[model samples]
Target: MRKLALSDEILLKIEKPARYIGNEVNSVIKDKSKVDIRFVMCFPDVYEIGMSHLGIQILYDMFNRREDVWCERVYSPWIDLDKIMREEKLPLFALESQDPIKEFDFLGITIQYEMCYTNILQILDLSGMALKACERKEEDPIVIGGGPCTYNPEPLAEFFDLFYIGEGETVYDELLDTYKENRKAGGTKKDFLEKAAGIEGIYVPSLYTVTYKEDGTIDTFAPSSSHAPAVIKKQVVMDVTDTYYPESPVVPFIKATQDRVVLEIQRGCIRGCRFCQAGMIYRPTRERNVEKLKAYARNMLKSTGHEEISLSSLSSSDYSQLEELVTFLIEEFKEKGINISLPSLRIDAFSLDVMGKVQDIRKSSLTFAPEAGSQRMRNVINKGLTEEDIINGAGQAFEGGWSKVKLYFMLGLPTETKEDMKEIAVLADKVARRYYEIPKEQRNGKCQITASSSFFIPKPFTPFQWARMYTNEEYIARAAIVKHAFQDQLNRKSLKYNWHDAEVTVLEGVFARGDRRTGKVIEEAYRLGCLYDSWTETFDNDKWMQAFENTGIDIGFYNLRERSLDEKFPWDFIDTGVTKEFLIQEWKRAMNGEVTPNCRQRCSGCGVAKWKGGVCVESKN
Candidate 1:
């Protein structure tokens, strides 16, 4: 029988006790004495939000497949439970075995976004582990970080013992095998880390050193140990179809943010959006076999008893076999009342037709992400979308019986102007007008056009990595301009506009491109009671500002200045296969408002071809 970590009294005091209890459907459990390694995987957020992440699920399923390894799961406790645990002096424990995280061999945290930095500290603090990796004892778990945010791991470098760069499916087996061998040979923790550093995609920050120039730019970034490579190459799983995927994922006891079986049809994106980090880092887009995806979908739905399945990809429209897959799913499961969700699809005739079959038009809303407002701005971002595209897509959706439309745009993009800001409203008004073009008798009543905008941050590895970010006041000003423009429009009654918090945007910008020096500010902020900074109700900007002041870190140095082409970025040492020269060329093209063709159109020589697979090879063939 499995023991519960929290007492009945403690569980009753919490809001959702189900989050702390284990024994979810399909969750793996093994005898502790039999396993050679005890691994605890964390998302560093609440249970519901963490459960929705597909990356953790895939890795969890992959890790637990090994007979010698028992992988458990943990999440950052919510504020209500966090306080109770601290008051009760209870250490944070994993869900599967109800064992303290400190007893595990490895603590792997998947960092999906920048706002969760403080929560990472919270996890370490609550788990009875040292916040900094350097302060940890020999018996402490080896803390490793992964996911998209690890591309710029310098900010969290002090907190993580090692960072697994790129895809986890590629070299994790080698890392675990080396750890087991080292432990059997009575090797020290540092010895194991040195061996792990030699493997591809493994980055041990303690073995590396960074020197800053007088201008605060990185003067040098090199490895101190022979085992640590100066340039850590990102690991890419060339054949994604053959890789491990979670068919029987652990179902949560309570409802999650995304309560459905997720089917990742592809990895990477062919469309090179200048502002998108995922598009840049995950180059040479790779697709899974359609037959395999269909098998996984059927198996996943059956294993978890989920009523819905969502196709996961950066861009679903780019998948070559999307039509066949969707058709097969509808024919196979539509009668069984299984819902098919297709996100990241480009708005087009085929997309509308496919969506109409699965979605109830009366309850559903059509979403279009123009990214930028004007044609020139769209070209600058390489969005490949135009005014004609937006109006036509909306018109088709309205005709197809979708009365509500959601438009997404970005503020404070590179070279943004007042006219560009106002064009956001103009674009929404144009979309609303397209819906009104239909006869009143044929319409599904007045159309609702809700346009939402978020301030852009200069993320590492993107063409806009060197772009300048605006202050909170400046971002709010841009939003105000767009709001005023909406009021001046002819169809103002039908259009509504909302913008993201400017304060959070500025802080996110700081962390996205920050170096090792920014770690101190994070520590200070966590000390000053900053947890769940991503949540709107919990985020206190004043505490973050105080952290910066206490640490003597200038947010302007990280976000305000436009970086030079020759400037050495903190993330330059991490080779992502996409060459710097190629990024520079794309940045110049963006400045000229030129649109780069997608991978299917032509090869622009972005340096990902060295892999000799995926879209790169497909284009050549």
Candidate 2:
């Protein structure tokens, strides 16, 4: 690889030129002579999107804090830029130095979602790197992955050398220290990976052999080395208040996933919504101290010059000290020309008070996930919210002067029926009625209720792991029932219904919970111009359908087929700190329409306890 020069002619061709031209305020640039290790922190997406991610920023800041290690950013080019690169015969390079990615000692990519799997392969191909871990020689970069999707890295096990199972903050330092020591002694990539596997949260996939049954399911997962543990523990940083994170995240020039400054007030949620993989995966909620959060927000507002600072968390309202934190940020930053926004909120009247603090200035639409329509349906799914809860939550919002509200729900949850589907309209109607009850003078405006219902995709490590999704016809029929029920209602005039494309949801379900066999669908889909399936424009259902047919596999087998309790799931081997028995118990309870107490009330022993040293939630002494 040669030293590259930035040309305006070339820059004009690429999308979001600011991405490649990396001259951010705090970006690291190292002298190759002094730096012992160079890490290309690659996110398999466009730069604008990846730069918006806080995890990349966190790890970038964490590793660069050390003098010996230098981490740089690399994101997959869009199709146009990718084509131009291929035409120009350009290899993938990091943003900061314009150096080829292969020059780096380590390549760490974040496996944030299953959809990005194809993009991983695309990124590797574009990088002039081997797509498979085994094909690469010692001269190649030692590729590793982390983040939530790594909990089910089996489908992508062959691609990466190693995976950081849980929170990277706790054990990432230990791995770095060991790597620095080993590399100083001229250790090989294999040597470093083998040693890294011994670390608590690091999982070296090469040491494990996955054998599948005739039914195309995992039969047994055997570890070749004693270093590989039967149950790999997930890392959890218990005290979030003390964690090293950026107060001033880089503010992107263009709109991205979340462009504004995001102050993550907490990590994880204890609500234990049965269908939510995030709730199960990111367990044992940890909140930053109120004072620390306020200080961070203030600093971020000053540094980034961002208009809105979103208090980010799995469930922002669930934080015990949310009121105090929000109030403090508002009081301190309001005079400084900063407005607060909450990304996620629980459906509670009390939760609305936190938003009430910023309502006058930051008048965004209210969003809530009732998850299901009917009370019985909600009980079966373990959403733990009654119809009354949502109805009242809406009432409070309307009374509090929020004119528009958005309701989120899923239509294809297990044990769903036409009657339950009809109730979705009823719930939307109820929410609409609450708006008219508001006094005319005090009322903000016409109540706009936007209800979005998506198809349910059963995911691993959730109580619905063994559940089956509704077929295309079933969903269409159910959707019709809901659509028609609300079409004629007087209160529903202000209600706007939006639904997820049933076909895409079906394909998403297949990939999300599918095994390596389904990888063929991904590869074929990408080959047939199915790049950026995450976006609506690039998501071609016909292409996926054709790929499934070409692969000689039934798409329904992965999406719509029910699994027996005895059958081995694709992600059964990958431990997410939650025991199978615990999930099974929850599943049984869900089927029986029994609501188990949340983890905070009683110990469900979801296996996060062992990893976090004791209970998931901290006891107030």
Candidate 3:
């Protein structure tokens, strides 16, 4: 049994004691002296949440497969444990060995969202590492940041020594080999970083200098070191089927957010939603073979003893072999009493038929993310979902005994109007009315349509990247339009409406499109106790405002200003396989309400095919 640093007294006091305890089943534990690299994979969130992420598990399995590296997992201790650790002066430790992360060779963090910026700082602080990369000594671990957020990592550049741009599995071996070589040669951290930068997809923030014009727009982002490339291209895994996956993932003693076996059916999305960041960043959809997925799912379920299995993908319905995969699962597991958890399938006739066979319709609410309320607004966002489609889908679902429906929309989108906002209520009412059209004998229960709208955040590498966003007040007013419209409905009692925090949305926009100068504001916010900004209770708008005020940065300049066609963004230095020219063209098309066909329908030529293979093969589904 591994010795725990925290005593039983402290563990018992916290909300989830299992979170702090290590020695979970299937967790990797190796001799520290035998491995060439001692790596700590840090997810800037609670354990249950981090343990649920498939990316971390896949990377953990891949890294551990190499005898040269021993990677352990660490999550930000929950607020309760955070207080206990701070008061007790206990350094953050990895779950596997209960060893201080400060003693590790590298700390790789996954920045999945902009709201988790404060937590990144908190992770560094708790681990006894310097908050800023430049302030760290030669003995400190090389702090690396990755994931979707690294495409525009300038705002937090000062904190991370290196940013891995693109897919996790692409260039890790080369980078790790370089680190090993440097260590064998007794090279310093800087020397290793310089050599690592030479590898593709590695962005050394210190090697580049960013300068801005008087207007606060990025003027020159040039490489200062020879190792730094003029333009760092993102790495893509050409063949995802060949990638490593953890059939026997580390199982937590306590339940996680996604405890079921997650079978990743595919990578990337085909639908070109102009406002979406993931659709753009994860360009050119690629899927696993249906047979392979069945094999993996069964293997994982057997290995982990999970009773349920979920198929994961950006758009599950878009998978060419979705029906085949679902049938396979239903046939293989129905007798065994294993549950088949479906992804966000379209509420179409086919999906409804499939759901009837696999799911309890009363227990599962049909979900549809129209993105925008009105058809015109939907066209602007390139949602490709029409009012007729929604109404028809809802009607078919209701006929199939699904009484509960969840409608997802976005407020404050570009070109949004009062009429457009009101249409959200109209759509929800239409769904309720459609439910009533079904015979009472066939109905599952009373119709319940839950509509949720999140504030539109213009993110980098999207058609809306150059678009202007709304203030918190403006966003609320737009949401109020929908709220009032819903209240006016005769079936208002059946409808429930919810909106996300506008203040948090505005802050996310500021950080998403911000430059290197924004790093100071983030640091100051962390200093003012702004950790876990993603959590509603911990997010203090006043402290964030104060940080912006203290840093002398106009939040509006980053969030509200509309950039010109020729303007350069801080993230322009990194080529994410998508050309700026293409994005600009798409933006213009969106302004004209022109819908671009999906990757399968017709090739829009967004330029992700440069790597060759995958879904960009013209004839690929």
Task: Return the top candidate by TM-score.
Answer: 1
Better of 1 and 3 by TM-score: 1
- Model 3 vs. true fold: TM: 0.98
Q: Residue 330 CA error for candidate 3 (Å)?
A: 0.8
lDDT of 2 by residue, 1-621 (tens): 424434688888777777776757667778877988899898888877898888998988888888988888888788877788878878888887888888888899998877777788887777888777889978888898998877777767778899888887899889888888888899888888878888887888888877777877678777788777766777878888898888656566566777677888888887888999999988777878888877888787778778888888888877889878877877877777777777787757666776777767235788888888899888988787887788788888878778888888899888887888888888898889878887789788677888889988888899999998877888887788888988967886798887888877777677678776676667677777676767776677788778888889787677767888888776665666788988999999888988866666766777777754566663221
Q: What is the lDDT of residue 574 in candidate 1?
A: 89
Largest lDDT belongs to which candidate? 1
In terms of lDDT, model 2 sits at 0.80
The TM-scores of all predictions, comma-separated, are 0.99, 0.94, 0.98
Candidate 1 residue runs with Cα over 4 Å from true position: 611-615
What digit string (tens of lDDT, one per residue) describes model 3 on residues 1-621? 789979988988889889877788889989988999999998898888898999999999999999989999999988898888889899999999999989999999999989899899989998888899999989999999988899899999999999999998989999999998998999999998899888989999999987778877878989899988998888887677888889889888899999989999988898889988999888767788888898998899888888889999988998889989899999999998888877767767778898888888779888888877789999898888889999998888888888899999999888888999999998899889998888788888788999999998888999889899978899889888899999998799999999999999999998899898999999999898888898888889999999999989898888887889899888998888778888999999999999998888888878776544434643354
Evaluation by lDDT, superior candidate among 2 and 3: 3
lDDT: worst 10-residue window of model 3? 612-621
Q: Where does candidate 2 have its weakest 10-residue lDDT segment?
A: 612-621
User: How many steric overlaps does candidate 1 have?
Assistant: 0
Clashes of 3: 0
Residue 63's lDDT within candidate 1 is 91
Q: Assess each prediction's global lDDT (C-alpha) against the native.
A: 0.93, 0.80, 0.89
Please give the lDDT score at residue 590 for candidate 2. 89
